[model samples]
Target: MLMLTLLGWLGGYLITTQLIFPPPPPPGDLFEVPDIRGGGLASARERLTGAGLVLGEIDSLLHPSVPEALIIGQSPLPGQVLRPESQVRVTVSLGPQLRSVPDVSGLAEDRAQIVLESSGFLVSVDTARADLPRGRVLEVFPRPDAILPLPARIRMVVSTGPALVAMPLVLGLDREEALILLDSVGLIVSEITEVFRFGRDQGVVVEQEPASDIELERGAKVRLKVGMSGRATEQ
Candidate 1:
């Protein structure tokens, strides 16, 4: 009875190992190579993986025939038999390496953004001084005058034209200081005399024509008053 049991166990083992298992079908042999030229890196990777092969490091080369991202050439060309798990090295075209960035300083923001995006670059705004409606091209990196090679992005700063800032309070500031503040905000100033200080502060500014906290148009002239008491000179 023991001998019979041993024989039965050996028979079951052979069947399971040889006929049923059979080394997992030799891991699905891959003896055929597929053409992956012109197929971008992503597509090429998928095909290779499907064929039980692994993609190796891809190198970029200068190829005049291939346009930018298109695959220029591949190794182990289409017909070679590749073993399963075999690594294939490939060289892809890096397109035209940009020698410099394009000039887009004066160009509108929308147009500039489009151009940069097409070149595979992110449109970055280092500093935005103005927005739409103010209308103007402030500046851009790489400059509008300079010529740039292909495969590069054009970064730019769009102008909102001129800045419109509310005038600062200058009631308490002295004449020179008030004039300085007015000039800083691009305001024009005219000096006049107000006789209200009653013998205090003669040359000192008595009051502003437009007064404090009043929003005046840019470049508009505002009058300044100086000095006190009944007979103040309105010069």
Candidate 2:
């Protein structure tokens, strides 16, 4: 009877401890951490779960090349062994940083370039004819206050001063004709002087201050000397 009772007690204890409620694994047992970099957060979590690990603290930061929400760094790096169910911390990318374009219009070319470069932008210079002084910035592409990714290429339109036009021949023509020609060529007749002359030269242009074919800016002032048969007067 005593032997049977002892056997029954041992059987009950085995069933309760070994079968119904099992003990925890030995402390020395560990699992190898899997590589989870360059992957999305969800996928990294799934990978960690499969490797008998748990996802821990998640951090994020702006990256120039990595896509948003993708893992960029991992703790307990790949191939490192750790206790099963260990927490693995990770850092994900928030994508590239954004920057606002600065106002550089009316600034000197060198200064404009400096401002743009200081703001982390690439600059390209192009020239255009404008009333502004040469080497001054006339405008900027994408305008001011525009938001774009960092290291974006910017194009600046710089002024090369006003456009130049060749002076037209006005001597030997009648006053009316000279006026018409100058007006058509964007030249303004600032002053006219009348001189007494004889024969066919009467009432006609005899001389000009800036003789023909001289390069001048549009809307430049021109002085003319016209011939009058009976009067010497300034107009």
Candidate 3:
């Protein structure tokens, strides 16, 4: 009886499995992954999804030289076999990894750009803080001297050094003193103009060209306003 019961149990188990389970479908069913490894993010996303896939969460990682938003790598690697709806696990190239921002001040704009590019960075200029002579680098973001990383985006203030600079204040100073100061600096004495505003004496400098205390390159010319009130003859 024990032997018969054991045989019956084994037969039932076999019958249930065959009836409950079926063979898996054939492997030809899957979505094709488009080759977008080095394309722009938006374009890649559009292309990938258009082809029947979705963009996975972006993972930020350090790269040494690749541009940002560029696909460093892709999931489901191009031509790899994956299920149609199977979420492909991809490891994209995070483009040249971001390095610490370098300090690029005091360097010429062109030179700075070259340096930054060599060190894996892209550079841009801020015209507002620039001087004349566009190629000269007037100021660099992140200070003058600091360590920076690759694939860095740097905005610099380039010098159009020829741009006008504000003149420095020299009011209340004697003509000789003013002339000396102006000459010492990059300023020239554009003839001194005499004015009689507010009835204050003549031949005295009333105003200055380029205004007071303005920054300018050496040799800037200033037109001085001198008081020209001639004195009446005292009898």
Q: Scored by CA lDDT, what does every candidate get? A: 0.69, 0.91, 0.66
Q: Kindly report which residue stretches of model 1 are placed more than 4 angstroms away from their true locations once superposed.
A: 1-94, 97-102, 111-122, 128-135, 145-151, 159-181, 190-235
Cα deviation of 116, candidate 2, in Å: 3.2
lDDT of model 2 at position 65? 88
Residue 91 error for model 2, in Å?
1.9
Query: What TM-score would each prediction reach against the true structure?
Result: 0.36, 0.66, 0.34
> Which residue pairs in candidate 1 have backbone atoms (N, alpha carbon, C) closer than 3 angstroms, thus clashing?
68-95, 198-229
| Model 2 lDDT per residue over 89-171, tens place | 99999999899999999999999999999999999999999988889999999999999898799999999977888889888
Which of the predicted structures, 2 or 3, would earn the higher TM-score when compared with the native?
A: 2
Ranking under lDDT, best-scoring first? 2, 1, 3
The list of candidate 2 runs beyond 4 A from truth reads: 1-27, 83-87, 102-108, 128-139, 159-163, 191-209, 225-235
Instruction: Score candidate 1 by TM-score against the native.
Output: 0.36
- Give the C-alpha miss distance for residue 70 in model 1, angstroms: 10
Model 1 agreement with the true structure over 1-235: per-residue lDDT tens digits: 9999999999999999999887754455656777888879899899998887778878888764576766677778888987788877788887664444555556767776776667555566654555333333467676655544554445566665455657677666666787888898888875566656756775677677776766655676788876653554656
- For model 3, what is the error of residue 45's alpha carbon versus the real structure, in angstroms, after optimal superposition? 24
In TM-score terms, candidate 3 sits at 0.34
Question: For residues 1-235, what per-residue lDDT tens digits would candidate 3 score against the true structure?
Answer: 9999999999888887766675676677667788876667687778767767777766555567666666777776787656545553334455555455556556666677887777666777776434345466666666645556554567778765564555767786666777787776558886776665667645456677676767776556668866655643211
1 or 3: which has the higher TM-score? Answer: 1
Error of 1 at 209 (Å): 7.2
Using lDDT as the measure, the top candidate is 2
